[model samples]
Target: MPAGGLDIRTFDAVKALAFIGDLSMGQPTDHSLRTAWLAAQIAGAASFRADICDTVREASLLRWSGCTANAAEFTNTFGDDVEGRAAMLAERPDWAELLNAQGGPAQAIAPLAQIHCEVSGEVARILGLGSETEATLRHIFETWDGNGMPNQLNGKAVPAAVFVVALAGDLEIFSRVYGLEHALVLIAHRANFRYPATLTIPVNTHAAQWLDTLAQLAPAALDAALLTPQMQHSTSPDLIADVLDLKLPWMTGYSRAVATTAAACCARLVADPEASERVYRAGLIHGIGRAAVPNAIWDTPTRLSAAQWEKVRLVPYWTSRAGKQMGTLDQATELASYAYERLDGSGYFRAVGGPALGLEARILAASAAWVALRSKRPWRDALSDVAASELLRTEAEQGRFDSDVVEALLEGEPTATQSASPRNIRYAAETTRLSSREIDVLNLISHGASNKEAARALNLSPSTVRTHVERVFRKLECTTRAAATLKASAMGLLR
Candidate 1:
């Protein structure tokens, strides 16, 4: 795909995570990049060493990395997770009032924050960031006064780099969301709480000048900071797919299913291995931009309002922007951005006709549509393969999908396409060292089964099943169920 074999590991971990983090936080796509840039400046001005400044920059980029892991909880706490979190970040005037109306204490976010911290920390660990960066991210939401999320550690107990990053984030977010005056007011209000006064005071004095200068350099400078050639531990773009799918439970493993089918279709129809592999990668991340929109919009069964639809159309545009920050994933994500386009010029973000579209674009679009058709949606039962094929063929006839691509998906389709699931993946079971019973348990839990549910299905006691699940986690070296599932999938042990 990139003049060599499909080397999936070359994905820029910072860009992929930062893009997802920004979307989950309801900030602009470059929000994390700007935040990281601001954090580095603050850290630099504080006379921190270059390495510490680098940690601050990276910590800021991944500040919201765990946001998706807590999306459902956030939606339950606040109707619109995106807007609610965005409002909280900007310290909107009515944010306090809105929280009061919820009749929930500030501490309610602790559990959500705990989940957030653990997942973010694990992501950092998996990405091979240093222990300091991981530690800083785990404490990113904490404050100096101990009125923070998760641990609530006070006054110097938190990592020093975190405070600098926090102050920088405030300056960047408030200055952009509100104005410099209100931003300064907000930053000053948080002195001795959000960060040490030593780090906080100078920002109020120089933020205007700093932000003005940042505006000139932030675009190129921030991009350079966020986009790297690769990480020490190479990461897969599938991680991006996994993290995004977490925001919606029903969509578990959805990306892989799309990818599996897309690859198979491309291989059969196009007969180009490299092109097929590229399509597969695109399928895995086609919905990364869907993170920018809230769960509420995607969960809707009915037609989206005109305003809501406009936001949905920008999904592709956001995906493309993320691509720019992604180093090796540049082309794959660009292909992903076109997944929604239709050959009839009836698609969104860009409405180009059949003549302008490439074969890979057509294959990805068809593959994505077919996957959606076969997969279950909130409003309806999953369509059977036959039923999905009928609908897909109808769309192809109407010029919405490429007829050949649609036929390729329908013809050479994996019988397990609906479950185009991990069931069929090769089992390097010995590699995971999981026993048959443990494999069965891991498979069940990975599909969203609870311990009791898995136990019942396996005809084993819940305690035994719990023990087995714990063993699976230990062996897989995962903490969260999502992490366990991902690792198990990667190990080909999910089956």
Candidate 2:
């Protein structure tokens, strides 16, 4: 077993994330787990090697990891009913037919598929899956007839494990949604095109038995049974954080940075070792809920609608729920759930404030604010150390942020420089169309500044500030200050 007690439980934790991925894709929570279980059963029927069967199971559970990263693009192209549509498409044998039916051009869908595959491979690597497993995941959609997205590997060119997962995933869905006979017919029809004949034969022969066994086993029991010793793997808080951060390009290293800074603050505040560790872990996974939100919102340079803002607020709540599902992460997840909360009860998901917010939560909030300020975002440039510190102090004075926590963060690193690299800064600027002045107005407004205060801060007239605010609102498609702030924060535009 690897150090830190990850062991087989790590696989369970990954499966939990896959469960979240299922929800993100608009499927039932057990969708990925059921797929993994079904895939393993099919692999067993095919008499595949033990290691290959394991890979098939892992790949099946994680097949949709990329979907979190590409959800915005998918929703924008396909519509808000992505889950139903995606399920429908998955049942179809022809990818080209589905795309044509959806009125999505192949050229547009191709890059999305490539990104999805690449991100899936990255998740596999981060979770320490072997090269074979990683490769299988990358080629999960490649068809037997060289007609799949991202890559068109034909026949034996596609990984055998991937073929097993492909057939099993479809079989599970079809069998569950339709009857066994109809599922068999669908499998037979797609035998030579969607899945290789070799794999399809085994699936067709044992489809009923596999379906019956899956139906008999409880999802929890199935998960427990699959956590065999050999499935154990090494993982750490950083690895998990990377997986969550992969949901958005702009949030690439946000979690790790927050964890690092939060740990430092905890140390400076003389927190117990356990408290420090818990806070660090909490900071790392605090944004796990981000995966549930569409990237279009994260990437939107403009303001979000009130409906969109509602989705943004629930991210922390989702993170808490996800943590609760993992037996080992209950405490840390609770802390993470408070990462977005403010001392003044203005925070979201749960509006608990003041005494309800503990020391650890305060440190997390301060550290998160500090890190975000130092990171480049689409609406504004990274704040200078002096400016960020001043902002924190100002918020504290207004009873919104914790003054002691803010001081602890500042004292933890008196000379800390901005951590946003030049490349990231450039990337943020390039992807956003907001001008520096407009960004300035938005930033002030996000912090609860009225037009007059914003005007004074930027050395402009109140009327000019109002005009800038209107322009910002118009560009962002928002009607209220709260909506603008929520939208800006979702896009990583706020500290």
Return the top candidate by TM-score: 1
Total clashes in model 2, counting residue pairs 3 or more apart in sequence or in different chains: 2
Leading candidate by lDDT: 1
Q: Rate the local accuracy (lDDT) of all candidates.
A: 0.76, 0.71
Candidate 1 Cα misplacement greater than 4 A, ranges? 1-4, 8-11, 103-107, 225-234, 411-480, 483-495
Candidate 1 residue lDDT tens string, 465-494: 999988987877655676665555545453
Expressed as tens digits, the lDDT of each residue in 296-373 for candidate 2 is 666667788898889889889888877645656777888998998999999988998999999999999988999889
Query: Which whole-number lDDT from 0 to 100 does residue 131 have in model 2?
Result: 80
C-alpha lDDT of candidate 1 relative to the true structure: 0.76
